[model samples]
Target: MTAKRSKVAPRVATGGGALVPLPVGLSEKEAAQEAYRRLDRRVHARLGAAVGGVSVIGLAQAWGDWASHLALSPGKQMELVWKASRKWQRLAGALGRDPDSE
Candidate 1:
């Protein structure tokens, strides 16, 4: 038995490269700087989400563990704090990238 294939022709333009955005009224240097700023903000947003997620998970896990034990678990709690601090440090590093420098 032979199978038939359907053909589609409307997905792409007939003759053109992918579109590139042109910055109106901005010099190339300014456009590059603006693009860098956008990229930096996007990175920061992603890093912020990661930091928040890790912080929440660490806190919830530690709280649940402590609730189950009901005694002092400073060691585990401190460990969670340390991990959260590390995540914050990662976010800080991401924030340290300068969009205007180079």
Candidate 2:
């Protein structure tokens, strides 16, 4: 007879060597967000400036888009939100898949 495993399975390695698990029923988006947060911390430790620069660029782009629509057409902001949401969803799906399958 063998002993059954009990703890939640860890998905990624943290910088300080901590193990963390995604909840069993996390949605793809939520899981991806969690994974990104975890990975970002590790990446930040290694490439803090580069990560900060890229993040600043992303924020600037988002702010520009929001400001552009905020004046001329506020309704279109919703579209931007959906577009970003879809991009994240795609990212989530990609994260959940077998990387070698592509």
Candidate 3:
């Protein structure tokens, strides 16, 4: 009599990367903020001085509008503004403008 064969699963070769799942607890607003922050990083890296003027101004204004929807504390608001100001200064410096002038 033939021996019964055990069920076997197919195996794939190594070297391909696996997909990672995002954390389960992140909220929609937090996700959008993270996306915006990443996009800003890419923009600053690629555009440099060209982003210092109108685009940055528009970004600040957009932040103001979006921020109003969140119930952030005064301290948190200040922290966000402070971080934005630093980036603005860096951009201004790239453009050869006096950062203090803004």
Superposed on all Cα atoms, the candidates' RMSDs to the truth, in angstroms, are 19.3, 18.0, 18.7
What residue pairs are clashing in model 2?
A: none
Task: Please report the TM-score between candidate 3 and the true structure.
Answer: 0.27
Instruction: Give every collision pair in model 1.
Output: none
Off by over 4 Å in 3: 1-69, 97-102
Across 1-102, the per-residue lDDT of candidate 3 in tens digits comes to 544332332222222443333334455555445556655765676676666545766888988977785555787878889999999998887899766888
Model 2 Cα lDDT, one tens digit per residue, 26-97: 656566678899798777767757566566667779999978768697567778889999999999998999
| lDDT score, candidate 1 | 0.63
Error of 1 at 5 (Å): 49
**Cα lDDT of all candidates, in order?**
0.63, 0.73, 0.60
The lowest-lDDT stretch of 10 consecutive residues in candidate 1 is: 6-15
Sorting all predicted structures by lDDT, with the top scorer first, yields 2, 1, 3
TM-score of each: 0.31, 0.31, 0.27
